[model samples]
Target: MSGIATYRHTQKAPLGLLVYAVAIGMFLGAWFTDLQSVSLILALVGALILILGSAFQQLTVEDEDDQIAIRFGPLPLFRKSVRYDDITDVEVGRTTFIEGWGIHMSPRGGLVWNLWGRDCVVLKLRNSVLRVGTDDAENLASFVNKRLQTEERE
Candidate 1:
């Protein structure tokens, strides 16, 4: 583990997020009749959109010495690490739009750490599953697989 080669992948916020934010604002403004409250609500919603767009905008995958670490951008609140010994299998998979973003439990089972996109690296752990959404799904899966192989030899 001393000379371990680390692999990292980062995802940035896509343009679609801005569009979504605008849609939310429009809907909120239309639903509320009070001009003062509507303005306040709009500001709050705008701030929320900015926070979500920036705070949870990125996902980083790292191959540490003996574990794979996944981090959601700028926020320490959504970081997780799984040791090689605990991972049973890793594969490239797809997630439906219904799954959405942020750190949450996937309907399919286990947790899903996604920033954007449907491509993901699904990890089957000893007792549970974890899906890490990434644009480079194949490379992430291969990286994990290689690490697992190396760990098995040791």
Candidate 2:
């Protein structure tokens, strides 16, 4: 028998829906109401927030074989194996405050996954680079690193 293990990251559906609703409300209110600057500012901010929030909110995990992966939008970013054996080193770090969340060219890094909150694990792989984001990401990174070390010694 083959054993398969799956870890599904938390869904940001509720948050996404809420952002959508807020954006729509702001846009509609701007069109209907007389307040110009207030309406325009709220409308723009709401639209930006909706788009950015939707993009950043995501989940990441590894299967039983320790293959790390991330799911964003309707597609999988990479199918490559983030296995411990393939990973040379795993580091936990956060983006600088200078980098804003969501659609910015230079992401300084507060958090990539805005909905889930900022915390990421950088995996130094043999061939490529991989990063996984999560709220408890530091702990998760430590957990995986320790397990890999144990396996390596054995």
Candidate 3:
């Protein structure tokens, strides 16, 4: 209920879901294990994994008003927002495998908010660069470029 959502996409990440499932399995295994100490440790670690997985199971990008908001879903512990005016350019690009999945600093420079794939839309902002990973690279790029155009016209 903030600005009119011009574009919204949630990148599905089965790998993320799988990671969460594994964490739940670990939790279950903890109960059946004979070693009490090991079971306690396993349960603690499983809880951590579960939190991370829920926090970043998917990535949602919304282009609304004057900014593009990026969020990691389910638990949404991480998020970012970039103003359209702050962005100088947008380019469709590919992230290196080293970057992998999840949010992190890109080896090639800048920060990356990726949910699942290697495809991304790189936004060169006034003070920073953000590589927003997306499965629908073409459409996201097109939508952003068009938004930039509209801003330039005004």
Candidate 4:
């Protein structure tokens, strides 16, 4: 892994998300003394947010050997790798907000592994397509293209 060229991208938690988390915590604290049922509900919602937020905290793109690897973190909930030989094309593209986030099937066909953002690098493989969301969409696509060219030469 030391020699491999890795492009790591991570998104800082948005201010809005932080504010929402705080609000949830405040509500839970305030209701703890009075309403047990309401406190339990808020606790569950807060837990869900914490879980999802941690899962979408970062994205990493790596070029290793002859394969392109993409991973979402701070948890390894979604990860994928495609060999240069298997990829037909790589293009920088955009994803609609409607597509949401996480690992999902794109409406246009293919799997989308995203943390949070519209910019993406789409990979057309021999059998299926894969979209990876990243802030450096162009750079990622260019890196993949260069890898494919090198693979073809060797």
Candidate 5:
């Protein structure tokens, strides 16, 4: 999360198909096969596929005055926040191909909160780091740097 006076952005990801794909696949598998033992479990879990889809359908980033907040939405079941004071540095960067999407622990150390693309704003914290994927990486990085400069002056 990047602290700000006012900033908000949402990045969309086309992951909503889980609602139909998962449920339909499970239903079809159960109907076409005799994997009865696990079919019931699959069917039950499949019923909740909408939640899965919504969870990763989009990502929203905003300023919460003292911290930056990022969330995976239309269901925002997962999120991360970073304080302006905690950020030691910020820069616009890109993730490697292996980094992939969604939230994960970075192989390079720290946490990665990504939705889709590789464009991101990397922030170095006091004891950790965060790579927040965004389509507006340049603007985000610039805004964060301004905030950091302001914080230093204060």
Candidate 6:
């Protein structure tokens, strides 16, 4: 793989952060009381909230011998791959908050940039799916399109 790049969406919403902060305060307050059990429960809940709020996502790009491979995650260990050749079209666009952010499996419209508010170019592939990634969507689309067109001509 070559020309690798990775990006993630925003960390989490402010409401989530506030909830965790309140839980921490409550847990500490309970610690000064006779009920150690309350503190333990709060601590566990706080931990879970923090983990859920840290909903970070990742995107990866690698140059295959004759194509490019792109992947996104719900989990880093589990990823989907897309080849440049299989890509039928590419376009730069937008992804709104209405559909939420990150690499969502059930996106309302299409694939999204996730972290970056502006939607990057999407690859409409032959396999009946779309992919979104790249720091510079326009340039990446041009680069890939030119490469593919040149290959077709050859």
For each candidate in turn, the TM-score is 0.79, 0.52, 0.91, 0.79, 0.83, 0.55
Q: Give the residue spans of candidate 2 off by over 4 A.
A: 1-15, 22-57, 73-81, 98-116
The lDDT leader among the candidates is 3
RMSD score of candidate 6 (Å): 5.6
* Superposition error at 103 for model 1 (Å): 2.2
lDDT, candidate 4, 1-154, per-residue tens = 3444655555443443674576578566746757887677777777776666666667777775667778766667767788889999999998888776778888989888876778888899999999888888888888788777766776
lDDT of 6: 0.55
Number of clashing residue pairs in every model?
0, 2, 0, 0, 2, 1
How much does each candidate deviate from the true structure in C-alpha RMSD? 3.8, 6.1, 2.3, 3.0, 3.3, 5.6
**Model-by-model lDDT, in order?**
0.82, 0.58, 0.87, 0.75, 0.83, 0.55
Q: State residue 38's C-alpha deviation in candidate 6, in Å.
A: 5.0
Per-residue lDDT value at 142 in model 1: 90
How well is each residue in 39-150 modelled by candidate 1, as lDDT tens digits? 7777677666655655676788888787889987664556899998999999999887888877888999998888888899899999999999999999989988988988
Quantify how close model 4 is to the true structure by its C-alpha RMSD in Å: 3.0
For residues 40-126, could you state the per-residue lDDT of candidate 3 as single tens digits? 999999999988888888889998688889999879789898988899999999999999877788898899888777899999988
Ranking the candidates on lDDT from highest down gives 3, 5, 1, 4, 2, 6
CA lDDT, candidate 1, residue 5: 68
- Clash pairs, candidate 4, are none
Question: Per-residue CA lDDT of candidate 5, range 1-154, in tens?
Answer: 2433577899887656645687789777666667787778777776677566778888888887778888998876998888899999999989878888878889898888898889999999999989999999988898888888887887
TM-score, cand. 3 vs. native:
0.91
Question: What number of backbone clashes does candidate 1 have, counting pairs of residues 3 or more apart or in separate chains?
Answer: 0
